[model samples]
Target: MTATPVLVLLDHAADGTLRPPVRELLTLARELAGDAGVQGVWAGDEDVAAAVPALAAQGVTTVHRLATDTDVHLSAVLADGLEAALAASGAALVLLVSSFENKEAAARLAVRTGAGVVTDVDGLEVQAGRVVAHKTVLAGTWTTRCAVSAPTAVVTVKANSVVAQDAAAPSSPQVVDLPVEVRASSTRVRLVERTELAGSGRPDLGSAHVVVVGGRGTEGDFSAVEELADVLGGAVGATRVATDEGWIGHDAQIGQTGVTVSPRLYVGAGVSGAVHHRGGMQASGTIVAVNSDPDAPIFEIADFGVVGDLFAVLPQAAAELRRLQG
Candidate 1:
């Protein structure tokens, strides 16, 4: 008997390609499925059949294409389409990337299917005929394990929490067109317009290999840090204090209350490494802290440390990096 497939909801980029986070989810689904099959869902108005090959390369056995013109509201339509897919496929487990839209959709799906919902799950597996999720709790202080007792399990994995690896042997996935009719919801929320933020030409903060973060010690001047990030082809990050002081955009803030990032290299300048700030970046592969005070809390976690003023050190470091690149 064929094992029940794990349904994965994949997000697409503007060019109709699957996003990196979606690829990560595919990886997680593949692992969780194990002996079971892995299935994918691409929900949008765009023709994303081109993504099937990539999904197949990631171990997806089947792909369900749903055309939903979610220009009005995406979550409602996606939830409705996913519900239909679950009913048709009889999939017991649904995996999604922990993006804003996907999380909302997962909640709606749980409500409709009466499935147990788990969010921000970084670890998932099948244990003793049940789906178990491992999630960080209390601001990354502890890890809690929870099992999905319902018939269907809806879980969202944090972006970049899992690495995407190629399947040992690639197979072409059978693509199925799922007919879905989306209607406007009674909810007053409507998408009037979408203003895309101007591109910064830097890597996404969450997925960047290197991140240069500024703190209160920078005295609000991020030019040096920005220069270093630009030289390293990385993203710019900021502490909560710096963002609260309006020295940087809130989107760039990294902390317990802000977004979490897991970069390969993290460079913190003038940061004292408060628990909130450390919570966001402690997972980085290598940490380099630069602070005037050698006793700064950031030094405790830093793989390398420099006791100096950022203004004096950052420019010198940027120049050296530029010269090395040149």
Candidate 2:
């Protein structure tokens, strides 16, 4: 029996460079597709030529470049393009990087095509010809394995969940352009202006493999936290209290009301582990907490906990890491 082709939504930057998560998705797709092969869905207006080499290296056999008249930023517009790509590629399974926009696009695609949709999935596998998605629930307290009953499934996978590897034998993938008819409803809301955020010269908080976070215990000083993050080459995040106090930009806040992160390693300095804050990062692979208060709530869930002043602990830890790396 031949495996069905799997399609991965290629998330790229404005300059046509593929994002880090797309490689992971392509690796997973290659495993699932087997001999049936893997295809890619490119929705952005960027030139697809620049991404061909990377996609081919990941064993993608073909790339479906969705050409749409409307802005693909709109979730509805992206869904319309995805529907066309599914038909073009004849792929029953689609993999996407989990994000607010991608989740919205996945939901809309599910409604339109009767495809089962799963978001923030950490793992996936085929069981008895069915795609089973594994995700955490109840604020990362419980793990659930859900099988998609529908013929088509759209899954948004979390970053750092799988290690991305290139195929042993690369393929020269052919790019096929498919024109999509934009729905009038999707064009109802026009995007007025798009502003790009200034680069922080650090990994993105939502998908970084390692993250260092600060809380109220930092006492409005993130120098220690920043130095540690830089040493580890990780993103810097802040608790709501720290952000509300104007210690860091709100974009760096991580919680239920802010950005959710599921990094491989999470380091919390002076974080008390509020329910809202824990809800965002509890799914991380390894949790390390450092706080002066011995009774801090974060210590309860931390895989490793230290009872010390963050100001004193962080610098020492960073220095030790630097020495070890050298």
Clash statistics: count for each candidate: 0, 0
What tens digits encode model 2's per-residue C-alpha lDDT throughout 139-185? 88999999999999999998888999999999999998889988889
In order of appearance, the predictions have TM-scores of 0.86, 0.97
Q: Compared with the true structure, what per-residue lDDT tens digits does model 1 show for residues 1-326? A: 12687899877765678867777888888777776778888776656776867887898887788755455146887888898788767789998877667889899989878999999887898888789999876655578999988888999887667788878888788888887766557234676777655547798786677899999999999998999899888899999999999998898999867878767789999999999998887767689999999889999889989999999998999999889879
Residue pairs with colliding backbones in model 2 are none
Off by over 4 Å in 1: 181-188, 244-246, 315-326
Task: Show where candidate 2 strays beyond 4 Å.
Answer: none
lDDT of 1: 0.82
lDDT of every predicted structure (CA atoms): 0.82, 0.92
In model 2, the worst 10-residue window by lDDT is 1-10
Best by lDDT: 2
TM-score of model number 2:
0.97
